[model samples]
Target: MNKKPNILLIYTGGTIGMIRDFKTGALKAFDFKNLLEKIPELQLLDCNIDTVSFNEPIDSSNMKPEYWVQMAEIIEDNYTLFDGFVILHGSDTMSYSASALSFMLENLAKPVIFTGSQLPIGDLRTDAKENLITSIQIASKQENHKPLIKEVCLYFEYKLYRGNRTTKINAEHFQAFASLNYPDLAESGVHLKINKEYLFRSSLNKNLIVRKNLDSNIAIIKIFPGISPQVFQSIFNIKNLKAVIIETYGAGNCTTEAWFINLITQTIKKGIHIINITQCSGGSVIMGHYETSRELIKAGVISGKDITTEAAIAKTMYLLGQNISGKSFKTIYETSLRGEIT
Candidate 1:
């Protein structure tokens, strides 16, 4: 007989956890102790659901690296007891949190699906139940007694996106997140479908290692027309700054002006890694394709390709935490480490 998969639902606070008080019509935290009753559909799945909630619920806007480390600790502590994990988080920072977790959980051999809803769980029109239900189903999916997805992923609005590849696109829509550069790993419809070709392949021999230390001394500078020298210098002058993400114009194009080019050169010389990422939503950074961007390539700016700003920040923090410096830093950042970039 096949043993039912044991899935752990980590509720870190969000709209998904909110339930309504029938008397007052106001929302309150859904009691996870009665989660099975709140969403009875879960009983139909061939899995055992256990839950763990944060001691104090936090708005996603206030989420920080400490919270991320706390999450990693929870997963690491329960690694051997659960076959898969589902996290209920706020949509505002879901992509960032998910992206951070993807890098933090190294060589994962089981699914970690992050999900949330746009409306309170108690609302009749809420999307929470479906999201919560499907996330567990995806987490529990296995083949030949082995897990199907072995990476951190965000499942929102019926699509399973690589956590690092996703970006929140809309604030009010049901489909708030999108993976513009990379394809969806799976999609839910009349039938939940898995795109096997897009899933992250893992080595069964490797153990999952969680990295808790994250360096936060970084900044993202968006290049704009008429950007003054004072403004540019102010960012570069940030004390102990290790890296910066330069949000260049389309195709990584930036002003070829001497002041701007010189700043890039000076920043690189100071050992601050400058990554040139396009401000455009769906295109890769082709640094040397244009005359304007050629100087950036010459100035030793690392092309961010199609990686989202959220992932860039998270990846930079993770790499910086590991003290990965010198020449190889650019090589590692440019390479597609967690399928975040093309």
Candidate 2:
């Protein structure tokens, strides 16, 4: 007989982890120790469950690399004991955190599902119960006596998305996230239907590697009309800046003005990597497709392809931390490392 998979629920703080006092009507963090009592339906699941939480719950806006490291450490410490992990994080920065973890937890061969709700768990019409419950169920799913999902993912509303490919698109709706360039890995309705072909299956031969060294010496230059040379130049002057992500216009096109081109050229020559990514929410950056962007190609700017800004930042920081440099950095940055791009 197959043993029930052990699932670990890591509450890192978010609306989903809160409950209203009912009498005082004040919101407070929900105690995961009594998770079963609060959400008794969890007992119906086939898996054994456990819970862990941050020492002090933080608002997702305050999320940092250190918190990412803490999350990775929790997963590492319990990697052998649990078959899967579910992280409850604030929706505002959930994509960024999920993207960072996708790169940090190398050779991941089990599901790390991130999820949260638009409303508190104690609200009259809260979405937390459904999201949290389904996430745990997804984490416990198995095939051939092995985990069915083997990569980082985010579940919200009824859609499951590759973590690195997702972006929070709505602020006041139940469907708070989307994967513009990738398909949903699974969906919940009458039945839980998983798109098996879209699942990421890493090779199981290698050991799970938790990379803690993440460099944050990076900046973003979101190109806009009326942006001045002085402003752009000042970003390059930030101390110890190692890389910059330029959110370029459609297809990675930018100003053809000589001043703009020269500044980009100079930045690249200084060994500061510049990545050209599309500002459009749903398309890939086709560098050199237009005359305006040709100079960027000539200046050796890295292409972010279809990666989201959140993933771009995470990927750049992860690579920079690994001490990858020169042409090697550009090459790897342009390539998809965690199913983040096409």
Q: In order, what lDDT does every prediction score? A: 0.91, 0.95
The Cα error of candidate 2 at residue 301, in Å, is 0.4
Put down candidate 1 lDDT per residue, 127-219, tens digits, no spaces. Answer: 898899999999999999878999999999899999999999998999999999889999999999999999998767998899998999999
lDDT of 1: 0.91
Best by TM-score, which number? 2
Q: Clashing residue pairs in candidate 2, if any?
A: none
Q: Which sections of candidate 2 miss by over 4 Å?
A: none
TM-score of 1: 0.98
- Cα error, candidate 1, residue 149 (Å): 0.5
What are the RMSDs of all candidates, in order? 1.0, 0.7
